[model samples]
Target: MTTRELTTDVLIVGAGLGGVAAALAAADRGAQVILTEEYEWIGGQLTSQAVPPDEHPWVEEFGITARYRALRDGIRDVYRRRYPLIDDARRIDALNPGAGWVSKLCSEPRIAVGVLEEMLAPHRSTGRIRFLARRRPVAATAEGDRVTSVTLSSEIGEDDVTVRAGYVLDATETGELLPLAGIEYVTGFESRAETGEPSAPEVAQPANIQALSICFAVEHVDGGHTIAKPADYDFWREYMPSAWQGERMLSWTAPNPRTLELSTREFGPNPGDDALAVDADQSRNAGDSNLWIFRRIAARDLFESGFYQSDICLVNWPSIDYFLAPVLDEPRDVELEHYAAARQLSQSMLYWMQTEAPRPDGGTGFPGLRLRPDIMGSDDGLAQAPYHRESRRIRALTTITENDVSYEIRGDAGATRYDDSVGVGMYRIDLHPSTGGDTYIDVASTPFEIPLGALIPQRVTNLLAANKNIGTTHITNGCYRLHPVEWNIGEAAGHLAALCVAEGTTPHEVHADAARLAAYQAELDATGVERHWPEGRVYAY
Candidate 1:
């Protein structure tokens, strides 16, 4: 019954990469910004989700927009400032100058939180920008084609704050706002007839999307004692995923045989050692050391000191991704149950490592697998939130299908010519399978642009979705659902909202006028936001 109201030019929901990008872009454009996050901290995947950067090998060279590229650079800057390596004795700046495979900022969630806070410091100082943390949208007021105001509930205190903004951007992981705002959305897969996505199943149903992950930290005990058994050990031990029928958890003792076969098929190197050795020749990472072992391995130096006081490596590998979907078919508390099952699987993997995993000459693993909760900024002994891989997509002006972007589907894909293009994203269509009985739906893709029409609602003029909620089919959603691309989408929405406010033009109008839309694209590009891939050579990693 308690409610208060505030006003802003732009309201950004979810403080993940997309939301952060929107915040930065809007604030930079001199818009009154109100950024809200359900979690206490910001930096969606990089900070709170505890997942390492799944960067393309050409990250440094090209393919991503300037803002996303800046984020990658910012991560590198953090590591360069933090570490004082022995390599500095020879080369001053060579003190852990990142890798070509991924950027240098390989630390815990807190590091990115700190980085995001620093990035927003200037905006926070200006007083025009405000961040409402631990808050989520409950309802939205729509008048004609515009959203008048949105009501949000704060977990910090039991109060509802109605934020009246010119525009509302939904950057949530599950696209939570689409349903709350009564926006029409599509869930689950689309049939081949619907999207003609070669990998698309025959019938599209509300089955599992991708499995949610409860990423945990771990450190080798060396000669220490054994780790404890997980509470739900029974359920995970009996797990046989639909997409994969291998053992519930692959580890030092057990490897996914299909992975080896896939590696051989691709002509990649074989580096499936029982333990990852920090050898001097660390440059030889082109092999499958990253592929086989890393999903479950967390580095010793990946977190801040005293954060966990243990060398906490996170467990989010291929083995423990629970194949249940939380947004669809609850099946009697699926989120809670699936999370528990995932934790048990990871913990059991740790246990097996200590009790039965192979040693140098085929002995058991070292005990004392330690975990770090400080990295995630919660005492729950797990990630702050589930590593959500997919979400409900809105039915917008243009629905990008697999044929439009997927490399497997579209050979030598060209950036679709759109007069309404507002943003750009380029990552492989990487869909980690779920309980729906699928495989790793990983498809290579070319750089693609986002159309402004895709963000506009047919019925709602005042409302625009910025996150995975936009009109992308499930097949194309695989590429659009990543950390950086989400940022570009949300940032474009923020720009569109500000334009709507200043020029009094709706998103549809902006797209309708070629001259005005061209001006908008020019403005975005002037501000370092690339709407399409510039001339660059594409390389295979």
Candidate 2:
């Protein structure tokens, strides 16, 4: 295999939401940008991982950048222009395309891919941006404290591509570039002594991180389409974790996020229920009463009587959360085993539904449950990759701890305001089950700002964290790892890179000099990046 060399003003090492936003921002300023993704799709969690946006209640009004809002609007436009929608459904001002009860916009993965491609079409045509799919970063070269270049390999073949850029962004899902670049970082949960988070344990658990899920989509059929029982069905069916309040692992009973009390959920389409009536605000309704509409991608009600054959829904519930082992910081073979097990667990959840799930009429076995492989572009009917909740974080100039945003710490005072704020986000500190044998650790948090210090590496001058891998501790990452926040962070990093290049300076100097920092902020304001939330508007569901 031959190695090809490429050069760009900025190179983004993960074409997820963050990478896409970063590339667009830099390329919009006339910077040559090269963005690569490990999967065929550009939107990471929104597309490849099969998880919809986990947004706050006010997403429809504000709390996201303009580019991000455009993506949302574009998804709705796809349905409006392409699909045969009812007049009432099409007339709503803030249309929820999928209306899956998980988020305001819960459309299919393919829809997101289309909208994102359209968003970046201008840059692609102008030759300012290049997007390479199915590419993964393998190695990096550094000079002093700056990353000079990175080597990427084809996931499907042996060809290697090397990219040399003026600035590099680590937007990979697991922060894979951190160790390869020899950058200082941290993973898993920090100790209470380190972060001063009330929920933190006494000792640090490097291997203890949130569980990742391999979600799948399915639709109901008239006849039986039950898949062959998964190989590990028996193992998962019989499994019961010690921390699970004595409920069967495969059952609907799981720990409630707001309160650790065990709660039971009901399954099935629950036909006749209005999709719009399903309030998704967890602070108000949790939205888990019925399984069918929870993440339904194809709601039959929105279309004409025969426009859609069956209602399609995505299965990303707690039953399939894989906490067996940490995927990163482990041997290659061990990691593969865990991934295989996670897939099996997801399949087993489907099998359980088809064979033993309880029904409203006290019946079992919905043999008509058919897996939808077309939705995910995978042969196995599962997502292209697992939904990642955490990433290797840089030990940044300023690390955001739980105390910064926790309502318990700040009360009505709200989140601690940062002088160098770059963007704003709001969400509860919602952590799922972990590989450390711990249950959910959910806490209330106020709206917070994405500090510029968090994006700048403490030692690395040219590398910037563009995703969940910012300077956020485990407790704080719970709130900072949402969709809008990650996009804001990447957009800020992209603009910072462009400004530094134009001024012949570094990010460190831009943050230090008041005049330079104000100029950068002005640039961000002109681009529609909201640096703060509305004054005194408490984030209520």
Candidate 3:
């Protein structure tokens, strides 16, 4: 036990994708930033959670922010420069290293970490950004309507650091600072009567959130890689989810998110499909029917022959979705227990795939399936953290609801156009099975805008919602919680915080005043932030 005190212009209390983006944005604006992360890796879903980017159909084109596009390009560049790519694969400008069907830019999480680190290197060298790894937010000190400082406890040591900043950003995966700062926030499902969302439940269920999955990377090779049976393997092996349509939870048969039909996914490792021919467009094809390539992280065929023995696939399917309990708003012990249980579920799924999964050639299992712990940066083969889909959202100046983006609600009219729009994003309202024992609530949604009002909390003056913690109802979080959208939100929040510090004004003031909001938006436009989607180009899928 030692204590340290530090001060910075901007304090981002989670070095996830959003926090990293926020730190970069703030530092670019000449503000000193202190970014912290609970995990050793910086990128949240991209690295620590080992989930590939779940992007929209037009991701390679104009929908995302300039920085996000740069990050994508950086990932591609790394693969081209570092990896031993085949001549044909190296020639392609948009190179997907993994060729995973879930996203057009599916690649290894380690590559993403490299790109993110490179992006932050200039700022770090200038001493504008200070990144603290293995630090988790423990407490917050708020004076009236503003958070002055946050206390962070080191995960590895007994040392603690209290960071005081001009502006505090809540970018943690679960909105950890929201409760610590006593900010007005909402969790889980909102009642239909409250949000007026067609997909909302009749009564608000704060405990009913999306399932969190513990992802892992694996490659099928000629070896016996079967892990010891997880302690809870027997329970999970025979466990039947209520929404699974009589199929075991550990089996390949699971309900499709959209159709809710029992669909058995085909798993064939190292299928040797043309790596360059992967067209990952969810609108054109939901490519999860093939389990092996659904979230493939490394396609061996794309590299020089014999460079890799097997194509590595990241397992993050519906079969491993842990919906029994939520990690948010629970006691520490309870959260730890559920996280352990989720890991057991994932391990059991892997064990089943190696030990008893029925093969296409009438075999019992694929004994070659090997867990790649090095790929995931974990000793146990599982991801460093769980893939959390939902977060505690702040009650803000404006709340995005299903009525704003749902295709069924808007029809040909398209999503609601916000006057205070700061960024644009597009994704379907895809919700996983919840702890409330409810199945998926998939809905087609039009391309949407991230409003400046959503980033401004109703009462908090200096604290901003940087990631999935923005002012979104439970129904709208399904769309806004994706990778690109979270990045956009964080970039906007960070820039706004810096702007407020420079202009000596608050977020509410800039959002409420038309002239001020316009000026702020002009800056965003100049910096390559798309405030609105193209007219008459709204594609709902």
Each candidate's TM vs. the true structure? 0.86, 0.98, 0.99
Task: Identify the candidate with maximal lDDT.
Answer: 3
Q: How many residue pairs clash in each candidate?
A: 8, 0, 0
lDDT of 2 by residue, 277-366 (tens): 545666677787677888888877787777767788899888999998898777668977998999999999999989998877789877
Clashes of 1: 8
| Runs of candidate 1 exceeding 4 Å displacement | 88-105, 221-227, 250-312, 328-341, 413-415
- Per-residue C-alpha lDDT of model 1 across residues 1-541, encoded as one tens digit per residue: 5898899988888888888888888788778899999887887777777776665444455546677776666655666566442333214232212221233234556766777788888999987679988997778876656677888898778679999887788888877777767777888788888887787888886565876676766554445656676676656556655444454444422233224222211111113232223321212343334532333333323334343233345556665676754544353366567666666666776566566655556556656555556656878557777788878788788888878876555566564656677877666776776657666776667678788887877777777777877888877888787766787787888777777778877777877788888988888888767666666565342
Candidates' C-alpha lDDT: 0.66, 0.87, 0.91
Clash pairs, candidate 2, are none
Give residue 302's lDDT in candidate 1 (0 to 100): 30
RMSD of each: 4.7, 1.2, 0.9
Once fitted onto the true fold, the runs of candidate 3 whose alpha carbons sit more than 4 angstroms away are: 538-540
Pitting candidate 2 against candidate 3, the one with the higher TM-score is 3
Give candidate 1's error at residue 18 in angstroms: 0.4
